[model samples]
Target chain A: MSTEIATGRDIALIDLLDRLLHGGVVLAGDITLAVADIDLVYVGLRALISSVATAEENGVPLP
Target chain B: MPEADDARLARLKALLAASAAEDAAALLAEARDAAREEARSILQDVWREALLEAAAAAVEPRPPPERRRVRQEEGTAVVEPQPPEPRSVPQEGTAAVGPRPTEPRSVPQEGTAWWAYCVVPAAEADRVPPNLDSVDPSGPVEIVTCGELAAVVSRVPLSEYGDERLREHLEDLAWVERVARAHEEVLEAAMSATTIVPLRLCTIYLSRDRVEALLEDQAPGLAAALAELRGRTEWGVKVFAPAAAVAASASTEVAGGSAYIERKRSERAAREEAHQRTNECAQDVHARLEREAVAACVNPPQRREAHGRDAQMLLNGSYLFDDERRSVLESIVEALAGEYEPLGFSIELTGPWPPYNFVLPSASALS
Candidate 1:
């Protein structure tokens, strides 16, 4: 039988993402950007949002 | 005839000379008075606006309609006439305008500057042993007029790195944690010296000129706000149940089964029922805790696919409370945990932290 052991350090990547992106004092402003930079953030974010959505649809919980 | 002509000419010349001299003096006096009034008005208008904006944001839901007109761009409020009206009901498949409507609305931007920060007085900063300056040698520490409030500012602009790549780094959780931890350290320094009104994270200014402009524009009310926040601290408490424990609790005998296979089948059904109940319990517990807080926010819970190794369900939260009530709040958590223990739930609470989630740009600053 294979049972997973829990460690204090073993925080899920999604948990870390939640705290980092959504938590803390958010001070938003007119953020300047270049085309390349915008493309990078856009692509990365789209992938993340879709991946998480798919996981939820499949009945798998995201960390 | 000759004597008469000479006398008239001399008299006319004398009159013209005196009038010109008097006119020059009067013009100078008028300019001086205007200059003085302009200086005084600058101080009153900007400071009052900052206070009103900060105070307004502190209120619940949307701030005043006038404030919504002011857009925050790079730490400055761009005040323009209202654009075309927003749709009363957003159309289907359209993205939300402004920041997420569900999240907190963007309050008019107003706060103390990056360079001119408030710190505990010299004695207080010293007494703290590890002042913000010591922890981050890159920042300079300046003494402030207010009690124990000292300002610490970085020598170089973070934007100077000119690395658009920096935002990508921000996406990294470890990198974000390092920055967040640094911010936490500064706040800790403030607590040691005096009650601190922490500026929001990633607050950047164009230059020292802007910093001074912000400070000059908003000194008195900002000082008053700092006074109000003195002696307060923030704390966080999260409660969750490990899946295994919850699963085990639910696995009980339904009907007597002579065969081992029959008993196993019953256990499987019981576990599924237990898991569903536990999920619901976590949601209810989260809602109750949020209501109890002076200011509360919930980060999305991580699901089992990502954190499958963990035993407990995840509920992320933060609370801002008076320092004196710290023990009281802890006791409340203890009581809640005890009450829910029979249901297989546990609570974990942490902090005496800086007021990270509660720093709204007050409305008073907008006026």
Candidate 2:
């Protein structure tokens, strides 16, 4: 078994979307546009209402 | 295989059509183990802090109510009576405008950009098998090596991914799903090959030279992150309490008080006590899981609309620990679930995911 439990039935993709879009290393500045560079859109789309404050508080450029 | 197994295989095949058969079989087996008879397909089964402060701060954490309101009724952002900061929510009014990039953006309006997916040591870069598809398949997935750092990239056409274009694409749920799936498929393939430091989705550079510069500039920090994150995996533990169950738990025997004042007071106090108890259950669970995790993060609970559930979330937590302890951690969560079931609490364990939660935004944490 894959050391994982059954969770997020329909929403696993949602969680994956959250991580793909928000989680992972941020190449902050310099050079071209990192997703992080131009993320206010995606951040606002899926996470605006729910996670903006947490993102702001954590300073993670998320949401 | 049994008929049930065959049915599951069919479902997996339908939900994901591109996975290699071997992977499907393997995930099928795991999904079988995770079978909770919930009548849903979840192969997509896809952190923390200082002990005291984080746990304390996470209880019922609420941002400004205005900020919490989405395009419900009014797409207008609430102007703070006193205004905390001038941080504007761009296109806040256009949220419900339906899958259209409404944000105003100013930058790079021409030429293609290399969308970087993840980085691995140059030594293992060759192992990141090619031929895999990416967010945009304008070019084959390739690697750019700078010293010991290697970036996995796909050359994307700028017309479809430019600042304004991409913002519009992000608004389209169908579009984001397709792109997100493609993005994750690349990382998952790389992961199977070697340890990787995943770049946030949509990391793009103007040219190969810019990508190389990134490898050079972030080398030490990146290397440190790779070293620190080498074998660890991120697992999520979410505790949910169905509304009815929690409500029943909150209601107490009203002491047969015939007096209206007495019954009213008791009922209100009972609800207050129940709310406090729920918070305690959450913190108690977090403390227990924290002991076993090298790092932990308590995320804001996913709203009911977002999760598509009728239950109230007690905890939405992520924990990172040695991969070898995966089964052990699973057991701990299963046991915890049973322990809290009586109080209307249910815990779920899902993981073996790429270490997304562990990547410190500032890799300097390693330095």
Model 1 residue B286 lDDT? 53
Instruction: State which candidate has the highest lDDT.
Output: 2
lDDT of 2 at A34: 34
lDDT of 2 by residue, B48-149 (tens): 112222333465354432112111122111111111122123344442211211133333657877888888989999988779887876888999999988
Candidate 2 DockQ category?
Answer: incorrect
TM-score of chain A taken by itself, candidate 1: 0.47
Docking class of 1: incorrect
RMSD of 2: 23.6
Mark the regions of model 1 whose C-alpha exceeds 4 Å error after superposition.
A1-63, B1-137, B141-151, B157-165, B171-174, B215-229, B245-292, B303-309, B312-314, B341-343, B361-367
Task: Record all residue pairs in model 2 with backbone atoms less than 3 Å apart, i.e. clashing.
Answer: A35-B202, A35-B203, B47-B295, B47-B296, B47-B297, B47-B318, B47-B319, B48-B295, B48-B296, B101-B168
Q: Tens digit of lDDT per residue, candidate 1, span B8-44?
A: 9999989988997898789888677655644544554
